[model samples]
Target: MSTLNIRKITPTFGAEITGIDLNQPLTPEQEADIVSAIAEYGVCVYPNTGLTDQTHIWFSRMFGNLWTIGGQGTRLSRFDYPHLFEAGNLTPEGGISTDEMARKRRAGDRLWHTDSSFTKERTTYSLLLAHEVPAEGGETGFADMRGAYGALPQAMKDRIEHLEAEHSYLYSRSLAGFPVTEEEVENGMIARHKLVHTHPGSGRKSLYIASHALRITGMAKEEGRALIKELLDFGTQPQFTFNHYWKPGDLVIWDNFCTMHRGGEYDDIHHRRDMRRTTVMAYPPPPVVMDPRFKDRFDPAQFEAMVDA
Candidate 1:
């Protein structure tokens, strides 16, 4: 714990953490320090590391329960560790779909998003391990939410402070021409969250924006569209982002609570690109009550049943 080394990559983004092998069990102090570092840095990279499946699960549990992907099954692909959720091309032997579906799946992740933001109780963190990286162009990029919020114009900041937006998994998948099933859309998997979220642990405010956000509350359709476009442009500026080129055995962990990330496109038709991601869920957001006048049209009992399902 005392022997660990932490190096900041940028004033607002990433950190290179050295010392402390992942294969070894962490002490209580070491775990505390690691959590603190993640809060401070947003993203941390442990390079040239090897972790067993059990160790990966144990390390991830230190933060919280591991987040299960919404539509994907409970287990990983046969080629991957059960604890890890695989992303990218289909395996040679067997997989969920053919090579074409895998290609479309990889393509859909190109836009920026916090992992599992569509869920009511979204994932708090994401741990990604590079098992196989394409030789050409499959880097993952992260945007610093704190930096994005800080750089906003005062007028824009004031406008969005009280605003809320609807996040939908269907919208995210639709961007790649792969929409979620009717059951998923009807099951209340979509959620609404504030445009500005205060970190529960640190009390720091961050821009809670992502490519999956479909609309903002109390704003006209055209107005919401324009505002979202403007904010996304400002938030994803290169200065506020860190792009990671992966090598095998590299493990990268980031706080999904205050960061947005996207996958860079690669030759999915040919080159093999595979990464395993695990998400940790957090507490649910406070409820938002609709107007009483609309109660008849928007039934509370129906909504509750949808969420409970």
Candidate 2:
């Protein structure tokens, strides 16, 4: 079994792990060590690691089933391997806004978010490899949600612990000017998640809120809006974030359950940057039932009500 050399960055955010070739299969012992390191550090950065599409997909499978987004293309051809999903520049010229790449550009350029926050079953882990990087800008930034929670005022933390927030792809896409179809909105593909979620394997508490979070349940509309704004602002402070400037051959794996990430702007018009990402579906959280009274409050039926007020 290969041993991992792990170095933690901050009390809450990142770690640099070495001593394993991602190209080869890991023994059960190596897998456990890697998983344990991830639990201890919300993000792990492996430098000088060259990973091919096959190797990347194989590494992703070691965790659990991969997450496939609705409209995004699958990682490899379905005939090859069906579970992984591809992310980043997919255009021929390696440009960001070719007609062929517009949808991905828009989705990725939007604010910080956990992968698939809109889905009922959220993603657990995300593995991304830098294939090409811009000479300037386009750094990926991550915030330690666990650290964000720990830094919150005691009263604020206490107030939101049991509160739940409604997360909807429809809501987030609307903010970014990409509205979802009516069919998707009806399927509960959009879900309500607790404001704070406990990590299943590590027992660490993390702030589960994000930029895409639409509203809080059981709270007045104005109040919920204000609270969401406050929490977002607090949780994304500089002290809680680590910005990664990429170099090719770098594979980063992060715990999506305890961290949030955003894409920083680059000179998309002048330079080219491309990265590939594979996400793992999370082990489901406990069940959450919508209150009958509030069901219509945020649903299509209340669109007019929301507009009227």
Per-candidate TM-score against the hidden true structure: 0.83, 0.81
Clashing pairs in 1: 67-279
lDDT of 1 at 307: 30
Report the Cα lDDT for residue 278, model 2: 80
Model 2 C-alpha lDDT per residue in residues 126-241, reported as the tens digit of each score: 99888888898878888888888888899998999999988876666655656566456556456788999897758978898776687789899779979988887888888898
Question: What does the lDDT read for residue 124 in candidate 2?
Answer: 85
lDDT (C-alpha) at residue 241 in model 2? 86
For each candidate in turn, give its C-alpha RMSD to the true structure in angstroms. Answer: 8.0, 10.3
Best by TM-score: 1
TM-score for predicted model 2 compared with the true structure: 0.81
Q: What is candidate 1's lDDT per residue for 20-68, written digit by digit as tens? A: 8877778888888888889988999988778755566567767765543
Residue 140, candidate 2: Cα error in Å is 0.6
* Over 4 Å off, model 1: 69-76, 79-82, 92-98, 179-188, 284-309
Give the clash count for model 2: 0
